[model samples]
Target: MITVRPSGQRGYADHGWLRAKHSFSFADYYDPAEMGWGALRVINEDRVAPGTGFGRHGHRDMEIVTYILSGALEHQDSLGNGGVIRRGEVQRMTAGKGILHSEFNPSADEEVHLLQIWIEPAVHGTPASYEQQALPVDAMRGRWRLVASPDGADGSATIGQDARLSATVLSPGEALGYALAAGRLGYVHVVRGHLALNGIALAAGDGAKIGEETELHFAADDEAEILLFDLPPTH
Candidate 1:
C-alpha cells in the first residue's frame, strides 16, 4: 500500500527569520493522525534567512540527520564539534543520553535551505556522537547514494536505528527502482521538482508512506532530487 502526503497539506510555519514545513508532528504543529510513520519521527524542510538560525537546543534519544540543499550552515555542539555544512554535505548527530547543539546560517546574503530528519533510536542512554560526510554529486546523479545507515555502509553517516536513507537525483524521463523486504516500511520524500512513484505523481515537499510492497519505481517528470528511507516496523 502507498499513501501520498501532498506538499500543500503539510504543516507550515513562518517565523519571520525561518520558514518551515513539517511532515510529522513537531513543535507547534501537531497532528494525531500524522504523529509519525513507523520509527521515522520527523522531517522538517527549513529555510533560514541570512544571519539567522536555531540557537543552542537539547535533544535526547533521537538520531538527527541534516541535509543541506543550499547555502551553508554553521554547526556547534557541546561535544566540541564545529564546522560549516554546505550543499552536498550530510550531518548526523546522535542525541543519546543528551546533547546540546546549535545551527546557524553563516551566509551574509544567502538563505540556507535544508532538511532535518529525526528517527527514534533503537537503544536509549548511549553516548552522544556526531558525524558529517560529503556526498559526491556524481554518485547520486541517476542513482541511489546511501547517505545514512546503521552500519555507516558506503561512507554513510552512522545512525542508531535499523533504518537506511538513500538519496538520488534524476533527470527528466530517468527511472529508478527499489525492493523492500517483507515486513519493512518505505518512505519517499521529493526534495525538489516533479516525479512519479509507482505511477503516483509527487511534487516538491511531498512525501509517500509505503508498505506491504516488494517493488518500488521512480520516474522523473522533470529534473528532481529525492530521499528514500527504509525503516523497520514500529513495535
Candidate 2:
C-alpha cells in the first residue's frame, strides 16, 4: 500500500525563532495514529530565524540525521565536534550512550531551512559518533544517490541500523525507479518541486508510506528533489 501524507496536514509549531513541521509525533505534537514509519522515528522540517536556533539538547540511542536545505546551520557538541552544515550536506550523529549538542543558524540575515531526522538504532548504548557528507548537484541530477546506509554503501554516511536512504534531484520528465525486496518497506519524502510516484502526485513536503509493495517509480513533473528510505519492518 502507498499511503500519502500531505504537507499541509502535518503538525505545525511556530516559536518565533523556530518554525517546525513534524512528520511524526514529536514534542508537543502527538498523534496516536501518526507515531512513525518503521524504524524512522522523526522527520522535522524546520526553519530557523536569522541568528537563532535550538539550544543545547541531549539525546541517546538515536541516529540523528540533519539535511540542510537552504542557508546554513552551525553545530557544536560535547564530543568536541563542531562545523557548519550548508545546503546539500548531510550530517549524522549517533547519539549512543548520550550526547549533548546545539544547532544554530549562523547567518545574520538569512533563515536556515533544514530537515532533522531521527532513526532508531539496531544496536544501542554504543559509543557516540558523528559523520557528514556532501552531495554534489551533479550526482543527484536525474538519478537517485545513496546518502545513508547501514554500511556506508557507495560512500554514503553509515548509520546504526538496517536502513538505506537515497535522494534525488530530477529535471522535468526524468524518471527513477526503486525495487523492493519481498518483505521490505519504503518511504518517499518530497523535498522540493513536484513529482508523481506510481501515479500519485506529490509536491514539496509531501510524503508516502509504502508497504506490501514491490517497486516504486517516479517521474518529475518539474525540477524536483526527493528522499527515499528502504526500511526494515517494525512488526
Candidate 2 structure quality by residue, lDDT tens digits, 110-166: 999999989999998989999889867679887879989999988788999999989
* Candidate 2's TM-score: 0.98
Off by over 4 Å in 2: none
Candidate 1 structure lDDT: 0.95
lDDT of 1 by residue, 1-235 (tens): 9999899989999999999999999999999989989999999999999999999999999999999999999999999999999988899999999999999999899999999999999999999999999887679999999999999999999999999999999999999999999999999999999999999999999999999998999999999999999999765
Q: What is the TM-score of candidate 1?
A: 0.99
RMSD per model, one decimal: 0.7, 0.8
In order, what lDDT does every prediction score? 0.95, 0.92
Enumerate residue pairs that collide in model 1.
Answer: none
Model 1, runs deviating above 4 Å? none
The alpha-carbon deviation from the true structure for residue 222 of candidate 1, after best TM-score superposition, in angstroms, is 0.8
Top lDDT hit? 1
